[model samples]
Target: MKPRALMFTLFGEYIQHYGNEVWIGSLIQMMSHFGISESSIRGAALRMVQQEFFEVRKIGNNSYYSLTPKGKRTMTDGFIRVYSLKNYKWDGYWRILTYSVPEEKRELRNQIRKELSLMGFGLISHGTWASPNPVEQQVMELIRDYHLDPYVILFTSSSIVSHSHEQLIKRGWDFAQIAKEYDRFIDTYQRIYEEFQRRAWNNELSDRECFIERTKLVHEYRSFFFMDPSFPHDLLPDNWSGTKARELFFNVHQLLAVPAIRYFETLFESAPDRELQLNREKAINPFIGMI
Candidate 1:
């Protein structure tokens, strides 16, 4: 889909926050602020309304709109999905990723270091740190989150061996309890992910009304693509490559972002009030260079 269409899906609900009666002129102003065209904004808004995300009222050559209950549910769900994955019960995972340095990319290194720290990673040395949990998804998300070029930096895990009891004590953690909780969380995550996959495989939502429903968070995807033009258009491991792999990869990856977005919806729902506000700002101003 076009960038503006995606943006509309992502932020259509937020328009209500500005005013109950969102006018064409107001939309024009908001779209212009993001380098979007009047036509694109109008089209996206109409699509959102059709999806039952918002109610558009026709008033003398102008249309004013506000979020429907579904829109509100979606926006809130989207927030929960994001924050839950990003911020779980994290305590240093008792593992470190280290790299030997030739001393050239100090600034670059520091940037990576700081970005990871914000994601709940902690530095153990000049070039070593442990993530708080065994969350590869969270680690990979951080790579995108920081907008870092992976080639410039190498990541390898440390081989420090310690008993769970010793490690947990040093980290001031309760290993058994956290491990049990992690197991439960993973099981739920897997089930939810499976459900999302099932829906994706079964649903073809490209009809006009479906388009409106599916495009709710397209704006964030558009922004992400713009931010990282080189993001590989690759598929999951199941779709290994030889010939048409690239095409399948691109299509699946593109479609897959929808569920990830939905997952983020739940994450945000579970976020602390302060963190939820921060995440909302992050969604709005993704271009602010890594926070």
Candidate 2:
């Protein structure tokens, strides 16, 4: 994993549990298990500050790093998207996007297209893309950021009269490929699930095991945000594997949480606001939807 990504995962998956700020020394130590060098971690932390993902707070001689407001918002949204579930009940509407970047600004065109794609928009035709979810805020943010407001037009449609729903879905999305990813996710975790079930009575998962397994599961499952458009049941194909995969994800995450919480809580003891943070985790854990 890239140092930058690992940094964010550290905040989202662990440090956020210990309150927003962590001593830089402690942060480096936490990442040591992943084989990241201290220098590399420091470099990444500095870059994250420059990029506005983190900010430093000083208490005397030592420096502690915490997610900036931007970082906190993004991480919260990301956690909800990655873990709470990929599928949201769809409203019967389509967010249609049409844009015409000048040929002279071809680079800008590519940039906009790439950003929209990352937000789950699928191309309908050249210069036209669509998403089932609302994209107004994200789209406008991009337009403003790139100064492409004059080139873009966005609209929402309650229904499409001419095209069949299946046609739109098939044309816009690669369900076959997504199903393959779901298969891979299920296969990866199914063994873990079986092992946990087999050892149900033993409760043998160590705190370290829990931390490793849970992090790996989270890191792997987070990829779904890039792959899934999260269309409702009607839009997806029959027997979509993502559904089954999500079920397995929830199960394995909860099973690991039992021991993982034990391990991470030990680290939080030194955090000055640790008690406040632990209470928040109690509230947020439900939102992690550990069913």
Candidate 3:
């Protein structure tokens, strides 16, 4: 994962609820185990602050970071979706959005389309997008942000009787290819699960190794956020491999926790900031009940 994304996983998965604040020095220490350099972690931290992700403060000789309201909302959304067992219930309703922009505003329209795709909306037809996910507030925000309200229209419908949901999905998304990507993710990470389990039983995985493995665990799992829409259970194909892959992610992540904490503790073994890392480390894993 890139530093920005790794930092997001760190904040959302580890730092958000427990303390909701962290020192830059501690972040650099923790991230370095994942082969990130001091400069890179610090630079990412600065960028996050610049982007309003973190509210920054100085206390004497120390710098501390806390989530801005925007960051909190983003992290909360991530938590509720990424680690939750239940996908948002679809209620058999569809959110449909369409827009018509002048040629002079084609670039703005394209930008909206790109971002909407990333948000898991699928193109249902020319100049139209559809998603089962609730996005009314988000769409309104997007319209306001880009001054596109005059050019856009949106609606919701439950009795989509023109075609079966299956046909719409087939036309709107490449779930088959997405399935292949899920399998690749599983293939890449399954060995870590097996290895960690074997060594965990033997009490052999060192803190440093566990730290690297744990960060990579989330980093790799997070790759799906950009690609998979967490489509509701009703929409998934039969015996989807992604299901097993998601299960494996939680299993390995929990299995590695103790050792990862031990390694994280070492980051501030003698620093005055040891208590800061220790408190967050000792807090219950944010993902505990999420599965």
Candidate 4:
């Protein structure tokens, strides 16, 4: 994985629980397990700071980093979606978003498209996107955030003249490819889960091993957020593999949780600002007890 992406995974899954801050040395030590060089970690940290995802402070010879408010909000929103078990019920109305950003602001248009895709909207045609999920409020927020209110229009419609719902879905997304990816995820993790279960039963797994495995598990599974729009069950293809993949992910995650937390706390307690971290209320893992 790219060091930058891994940093987000680390902060979201681990560091946020311990005051949402970490000494640079502590971060380097943790990232070492993934074979990331100290220089690379520092470089990634600096880039994140530039992107407003992190705030850094110097203390004597060392530096500490913490998530900015924007970063925290982003991580919180992501985690909510990642761990959500709510089966979205389609209301039979499609939310359509069409934008006509000026050519002078091409970058802004690209950003709007990226945000729409991340929010599960799929492009149905040039400058037009749609989602069966109710996300009008989110689209409005995006519009206001980008000051694109004049360039964008949103609509809710229950009818399409040219295509049926299934046809629209096919035009907007490659479900066949998505299904193949889900199959791969299920196949890979099912074997890992079986092996981990055996090791756990045999008392052969180390706390550090559990931590590594759990982090890797979450990191790998988290990619589905970008790949899967998480359509309602009724809309998914028959015998979709994503359902089985999710179950496997949660099962393995729960199996690794206790030892993973133990290992993380061991590192966290040794940080230079341990007292401050200890005094802060711990945030619960969203996946805990949700399986």
Candidate 5:
């Protein structure tokens, strides 16, 4: 994992629970298990600060980092999408968004496109995006955030006889490619899950090892947020592997949970921010009890 992405994973999975802040030394120590160097962590932290994802505070000579408000919002959004199963029945309407961002503001246009893509909006045509899911609120938030209300128009409507839902989906996304990626994830992680299950039962896995595996598992599975639109069951193909993959991911993740959290808390307890650690209740892991 890249240092920046790995740092986000750590914060979402562990640090946020403790107080949403961490000493640089503690952050480096946790990242060291992933083979990320201290220099890389520091550089990534600096970039995150510049990008407004993090804010830093100095305690004597030590530097502590915490998520900015934007960072918290990002992590919350990501956590919900990654950890929650999307099983809602889709309304038979499509949300269409069209934008006319000016040439001078091409950067903002690109950012809008990227965010839409991440939210599973597929490009139906130039400057037009559509999704079966109801994302009017998200789009509204985006428009408000970037002040693009003047250039963007959103609509909720059903297709006329000219095009079918399947046709529109085909125009928008490559389900075949998505299925193949799901297959790859299942194949790679199934073996790791099985092996770890055996070792866990035999008491051969260390807490540290469990922590590493769990972090790696979450990091890898989190990629699906960008790739999988997570269409409703009725929209997915009959042979979809995503469901099976999700089941396997949750099983492996649950198996590793206790030891992983144990290892993390050990490091967290030793952090220099003693008052925060002492007063804080046990961190509620969002992964636990999740389907």
Candidate 6:
């Protein structure tokens, strides 16, 4: 898994499975379940602490940890991403029914509409909505939770397509003429992948550094859609295997460290550009001094 995803996974497990409190052994055991080493787990914990997402308590030689409010926020964000990446929650319905309500109720309707839309509802008609998926039980719960009325049943229909415009934008999957942009995205993806792979091998990265790197990649990937917000979600084609993009991302993430390190190596071998030359020397200065 990518570092960012892993961080979210670990954080989510802590918040959901375990109580808020954890210790080094608990942390190690949790990571071991995921096949990560104790040292790496400790590193991740320290990084989280630095980010103010976790608080560490020292009791003699052992340290206990718990999520700070910031940590909870991090977990919340991670949970959303994890859901996006692991879309098993989806029930294949993507259609929606929409209609205008009384002006007084429009605000309530809009709120429900936005929430339902995020869950992938398509608007088929005014005041009528359908989900291309069988609405998850959670959806029904949310409606009840929000205290929506029986008249709102139209919002839960199965006749509308589910891949609504907002879902595509939120998932950063919205694109038009991907064929034309394919080359550009491929190049950027390959370059960044290679750069990150190299960073992995050296094991030189501090846990915080690794986390930041992974976060940046996710942001960059998401930014692709942000650049062209005008693209219609309906026109964007989607592959049904909603799980594939995440699988590919994890594979690419592992492969990225190599290129990252190689790019650094090339920088040192060739005199870099002006700004880069300064940075190269700064990076090497300590090692050179040691020699």
* lDDT (0 to 1) per candidate: 0.42, 0.74, 0.74, 0.80, 0.82, 0.47
TM-score of every candidate relative to the true structure: 0.30, 0.81, 0.80, 0.88, 0.89, 0.43
Q: Please, what are the lDDT tens digits per residue for candidate 4 over residues 1-291?
A: 788778878788878767778888888888888899999999999998987779988777888898886567556555656777776667789889888988999998997887787677889899999988877867776776668878999999999999999999998888898888989988898899999999999999999999898889888887877767778878888888888888898799889887887887777623464565542223335565332
The TM-score of candidate 5 is: 0.89
Off by over 4 Å in 1: 1-16, 19-21, 82-86, 89-291
TM-score of 1: 0.30
Give the TM-score comparing model 3 with the true structure, all chains together. 0.80
lDDT of 4: 0.80
Relative to the unseen true structure, what is the C-alpha lDDT of residue 112 in candidate 1, on a scale of 0 to 100? 61
Judge candidate 1 against the unseen true structure and give its global Cα lDDT, from 0 to 1.
Answer: 0.42
- Candidate 5 Cα RMSD after full superposition onto the native fold (Å): 2.7
State the TM-score for model 4. 0.88
Scored against the true structure, residue 179 in model 2 reaches a CA lDDT of: 93
Residue-wise C-alpha lDDT for candidate 2, range 1-291, written one tens digit per residue? 667777777678877766667888877766676788999999999998986779987667777888886567556655666665445567888999999888899987986776676577888788889988866787776666667778999899998888977788777789899999999889978997999766755867678777667777777777676667766666778898988988898788777776776766555423353344454454235344532
Sort every candidate by lDDT, greatest first: 5, 4, 2, 3, 6, 1
Query: In model 6, which regions exceed 4 Å deviation?
Result: 1-101, 154-189, 216-244, 252-291
| Off by more than 4 A, model 5 | 269-291
Number of the predicted model whose lDDT against the real structure is largest? 5
Q: What are the clashing pairs of model 2? A: none
- Name model 3 segments beyond 4 Å from true: 87-89, 99-118, 135-154, 161-163, 265-291
Per-residue lDDT tens digits for candidate 3, residues 6-112, read 77777776665446677778878777767899888878888888777777777767777778865665555555565777654567888889888889987877878
Across residues 1-291, which tens digit of lDDT does each residue of candidate 1 receive? Answer: 453344344453333223334555655654454456888878877787776666777766666666676555444333332222121232433434564434686766665654444333445455655543454554555445444444234354433455442352334323344334435434543454455457667784323322233333234322222111111123111222211322222233345444433433432221111122224443332322421
lDDT of model 3 at position 134: 79
Tens digit per residue, CA lDDT, model 6, 173-222? 32444334544556665666666567666655554444335434444444
